[model samples]
Target: MIVPICSCYGQTEDGILSKHEKWEFVLEDTGDVLQIAIPLAAGLTTLFKKDYKGSKQFALSYATSLVVTHSLKRIIRKERPEDRNLFDAFPSGHTTSAFSGASFIQRRYGWKYGKWAYLGAAIVGVSRMEGPDGWHDIWDVLAGAAVGIGSTYLFTTPYEKQPVQVGFYSNGNDTYILSLKYEF
Candidate 1:
């Protein structure tokens, strides 16, 4: 997917900072789309499963992340890495959105499914620090991720409920029926 975008910008060394300008551009655009897509996708998944509770949980987490991220950005008034004149750069909003969705997926579904979302979220973080035109520093990205994950942790729970399982266990000549329920 990235190969075509990289080739379009000609050579990477031609960039102002000798960084892959094409990669930076592609990453920035991709990250922008992903920030929205991830949350939408999570929402769709919940709808497909008919899990309204999970949907509400994810929405709350996402909303909390947005509020917290924007509040911090406004309060800190930190300058962007690329331009000191711009102030709302203390927390990368793109990273916050991406991580919020990713963490919600992990919290609701499970790691087996959420790992891919996390990988995409990590890419969004990288995009924020990719090139001369990068918008944020590591601190901003880290804080955004922390806020996202923290918010989700406060609201989300697993989609699958562990029900009591009644089964028979046999060892040698002994047989027993047991009921089990696993707790988080």
Candidate 2:
């Protein structure tokens, strides 16, 4: 993705500096959508499935993350790359929201759901760095990822804590994989 976009934009450097696919912008937009949609989806799904506790947990996670992300944005006051603003760029809110939803799905369900969700979240973060106007640095994306993952972890710990996990997956096409995870 970066190869083609960088080549076209004349940015052959290895560092983040902007210009990628328009679809990358769409990915960020999807992150924006997920911020709202994930909580709604989780809450409603749990409610309809008669899992009241899950619904409450999901709501709590979303609210706390939203508050924390915004508060940090105000406190940090970092500047954007394109001079769009003098502050509010320490962390990418879109990335935070995307990771929040992705992490929530992973923590609540399993890696099967998490793998794809996290990929989407990562794409959202990358999209933020794909254009100058987007104006999100690598650190911004990292902080957002951390915040999103931390919030979800904090909220989901009580409900579903996986101390350790070992699993395997098969694509039914002679492709098989083994995985392991340990959570403190």
Candidate 3:
């Protein structure tokens, strides 16, 4: 239902492909490689910080979500708008992967990094729209976000203690600092 509506409303082939060509400069295979690698690194960092279970949970969730989405896409085999390929576009896999990473970061670091994390996810959504092999509408991106965030939160262990006082401060010398005081 949602997929069909999105597909109907999305930009035509020329519009979408034009954007794709522009984004190709920055969002090519190398970019995807970085996207995949960075999140795994962040998850490992969480593990080293003694959140071993949480890290493992995030890693597994991310991987599982990607696999499931990709498999479903393969089975559906919906054709891309440009006819460049045949894979389901009901949900954007790259967007899902981006959201999964962002969710992991938010869970491990709290809301301090939330803005940037979500910004990255948004970029992925846009990239998906721009790419030849991409999703057509907001629904697809939303669906991907749901799967990514849901999997991460459901699989991770709850924080032992929430941060009591989390805030930021700026000095007169144009310097800023963030402080987190936790109570366990």
Candidate 4:
């Protein structure tokens, strides 16, 4: 299965290179997407109420995945399809990083946000294939994604805290008091 997928991606890479030079810009800009996803994922961590540990877990998982993927790239040192570059392309570093950040966002938020993050990750993966280097096969992207998602789940503690609600009420005299309650 992996071999066939890699072959298909190689074929697709040819078509992308032949058809679209403009895609190079898109490929380059995917770095900015990763920049944004990381911070946004961190911000979403606060929404889990008392799950500070979970927040740390999410952040750490993302960082660890990035390091692991990049290190593996150096070790494998597979040549890019274009041969213009000699850098390893066996498991896409860009795709791994993007998915790591995206998975962090998705785990902290809900599917609505997860869907958008995943879509952005897809774009990054496609951009890698479209780049001038023409590195990475479909299996590479898939493996990178699995590594990212798996690490995120493995590191993050499950959300087990009960929800707490805080409300503000104002009296006629313009005085306000906040009331707090725990649910479940």
Off by over 4 Å in 3: 1-24, 27-34, 131-137, 161-184
lDDT tens per residue, model 3, 19-49: 2244343554433654565466558767777
Write candidate 1's Cα lDDT for 1-184 as tens digits.
5544343333232243333446667777888888888888888999998999998998899999999999999999998875447899978899999999999998899998799999999988998888436789999999999999999999998887545555667676766657575566
RMSD of each: 9.2, 13.6, 12.0, 8.0
Lowest-lDDT window of 10 residues in candidate 3? 1-10
TM-score of 2: 0.67
TM-score: which candidate is best? 1
Q: After TM-score superposition, what is the CA distance of residue 136 in candidate 3 from its true location, in Å?
A: 5.1
lDDT of 4 by residue, 11-105 (tens): 24334523334446456467446645644655475554656776678678877887788887898877767554566676777777777767766
Deviation in Å, model 1, residue 162 alpha carbon: 6.8
User: What are the runs in model 4 whose C-alpha is more than 4 Å off?
Assistant: 1-20, 30-51, 158-161, 164-180
Task: Answer with 3 or 4, whichever has the higher lDDT.
Answer: 4
lDDT of 2: 0.73
lDDT of 4 at 33: 68
The superposed Cα distance between candidate 1 and the true structure at residue 177, in angstroms, equals 28
TM-score of each: 0.77, 0.67, 0.63, 0.66
Model 4 steric clash pairs: none
Between 2 and 3, whose TM-score is larger?
2
Candidate 2 residue lDDT tens string, 1-184: 5365423232423454454566655665675666556545556656676766767677778777778888988998998776664698878888788788778777877787678778878877886787435658999999988888888888774345458999999999999999999988
